[model samples]
Structures are given as C-alpha cells and as structure tokens.
Target: MRGKRTTTGAAVMIGALAVTGLTFAPTAAAVTPTTATINASCGLFGGGAATLTATQNGTSATITLSSTAIKTPLALAADSITSKLTMVKASGGTTVFSGKKNPAMAAQSPVTVGPLSGTVASGDSLEFYGGSLQMTIFGISVTCTASAKQSPGPFVFD
Candidate 1:
C-alpha cells in the first residue's frame, strides 16, 4: 500500500509538471488579412457623368455614345465601331465613358450620360446610353471621358 501511494503521487506530480510546461511553450504569432472580394451586380453608385450603353454576354461589352464635347473629327459607325469597357470597381479603379460628336454640324449639344455626374467611392459600377447612333455622314472628331471606383463589391453577373 505504501509503495502504491508513492507511485500514485509521482504520477500526479508528473502530470502537473507536464501541464505547466505546455502552458509556457510558444509556437507561432498572429496573421493578418490582405485581400477581399465583394459579390454584387447592378453597381450601387458612382458610374459618373459620361453616358454609356451596354449589352453583356460573357466578357464582351458593347457600348455606344450619342454626345461629346468635340463634335468634329470622326464619324462613328452606326454599328461599325466598338471599344473596351470595364466595370468600375468602387475601390477607385478605372471606368470608360464613350460618346460621339460631329461639331461640324454647327448646332448640336453634347449628350449627358449617367449614374449622373457625382462622387464615387471604391467598388461601385453602372452604365447608361441607348438608341440608334447618328452622325453627319462623314469622318468627324469624337472625345470621350470615363469614370470608375474601387475597393467595393464584385459584378452581380458573375
């Protein structure tokens, strides 16, 4: 009985010591986050003032313009012209604003696109514009402006 008590006490002491050692042991430190993704579509806001028209089927986006500051230089093909555009990331990224002008006509006003001209944050997107495109039937100059936002959500289409 005496021998058994001593063995039992030693076992208890060993367990206590093991627990104490584990408590003091060190392994690694803390980690941080760097990247994030937002999932949404029909961007909430900040598409900008320049107008836009788009039809999406996969990665290809087709857009047209009806107004611009300079109305003389190039005649945009009714359907013969196209440009690349990206969804404006509300986090402060790049966006595209396309429009047409035939200043040679001498009595026209530039069309205003929307989401309306306003301030945008990171990661919001939207587009505007529609209808058959027209021109003076000759090559004329066309100027385009664009807007975009970053640090926000993803395209609802994807």
Candidate 2:
C-alpha cells in the first residue's frame, strides 16, 4: 500500500508540472522579425550610393544605413554632406518611416534609424535622399542634392 501511495503522489506531481509547463510555453504572438536589404543611389554632380538594411518586428522597424563613398567633381569633405533614409507604401505613396536627422556622409559608420511605428509588410518601397552638401572650397560654397529609390519587389514573411 505504501508503494501505491508513492506512485499516486508521483503521478500527481507530474500532472502538476505538465500543467505548469504549458503556462510557460511560448505563445503564437511571440516576436518574429523580418528583414530586407536596401541599395539605392542619389545626387547629381557627385552621386553616392546608400546601402542599408531594414528589420521589422510586428509594426516596429529599424533601418541601418552604412556610410557610403562618394565620387564628385568638386573637392568635398564628408562632413558637409547629410543623408536621410525613408520607407513608404508602394500602393498609396504614404510615408511610413523617415529618419529624424541627417547624418554626415563621412562618418564612415553605420547609421541606425527607427523603432518607427508602421505596418511594414511585403512590397513596401525604400528611399534614400541626401540634402545638398555645401562647403566653402577656396571661398566658394558648393551645394548638391542626391536621392535614390528602390522599387517594390517580392518579399516573404515568416
């Protein structure tokens, strides 16, 4: 009878643990992130490419733009240039996420933008626009604006 009671107690404990395990299990709403690559160019006289990556978690997103190398006709310094990254809906042309500040071009470091709130689904467009850089080269101020856009393409969500 003692063995039977021990077996019953063990079984009850196992049942309790099983129930507790279910409570701690991950639910369906767990974080699942999606990512996309961005490669675009902008500017006229001295055009530069903006290479960036975008990651989306639910309705929040983050964009990281890597510093780009520029080729221009004038003697320019990286500090004089500023770049901005944006994401927009392809169908309705609504701006979803825009970078808050324009970082200098010569930073040579990755610039991160967001946790911007938006529904970033498949087929959204990415844009990179740089404000014209102005600097006094030999007592003359030079300015140039550059912008690039990526077309909506196939994207998969897991």
Worst 10 residues of 2 by lDDT: 149-158
Which candidate leads in TM-score?
Answer: 2
What is the alpha-carbon RMSD of candidate 1 to the true structure? 18.2
Cα RMSD to native, each candidate? 18.2, 8.0
**Residue pairs whose backbone atoms clash in candidate 2:** 42-147, 43-146, 43-147, 132-144
Candidate 2 residue lDDT tens string, 122-146: 4454343322223233354344334
What C-alpha lDDT, on a 0 to 100 scale, does residue 5 get in candidate 1?
A: 100
Worst 10 residues of 1 by lDDT: 30-39
> Against the hidden true structure, what lDDT does model 1 obtain?
0.33
